[model samples]
Target: MRMIQRRIRERGEREIPARLIGELVMEALRDLDPVAYVRFASVYRRFEDVDAFSVEIARMKEAEVPGGGDDPNRGD
Candidate 1:
């Protein structure tokens, strides 16, 4: 919601594009929780198979945040 609010403020409360709103919501979910992000991304991006899930997860693993993001597959 903060993202949307910020965009609204930036745009002087003008009509925001649905695509931008969706992207912001997805971004907020990603920052809040990986599982949630994946869940939303799957639906939003219309993921159709395990391959899509794997790809999104792999992309997340690669973009791991600093001082966090332990490898889920490495048994850390």
Candidate 2:
């Protein structure tokens, strides 16, 4: 939470973009907890169909491949 606050402060903007906040949350969860990240992302992005979930799962799988996923800290 403090990290996010610091980021907002550093931006020096009165209004923070929703995308920035989503990225921050995603980055934090993706490193610390992938499952939670995915879950949160689904809700944050408001996935109302199975297709959306599939796409996200595919992305995760792609990341699982060698040198694919951006974050090396992700667990199997």
The whole-model lDDT of each prediction reads: 0.82, 0.84
Shift in Å, residue 62, candidate 2 = 2.5
**Which runs of model 2 end up more than 4 angstroms from their true locations?**
69-76
The most accurate candidate by lDDT is: 2
The weakest ten consecutive residues by lDDT in model 1 span 67-76
List ranges where model 1 is wrong by over 4 Å.
65-76
lDDT of 2 by residue, 8-35 (tens): 8999999999899989988788778878
Could you give candidate 1's per-residue lDDT for residues 1-76 as a string of tens digits? 8766786678775577877778888888887899999999999899999999999997787677453566566553
TM-score of 1: 0.75
lDDT of 1: 0.82
TM-scores, one per candidate: 0.75, 0.69
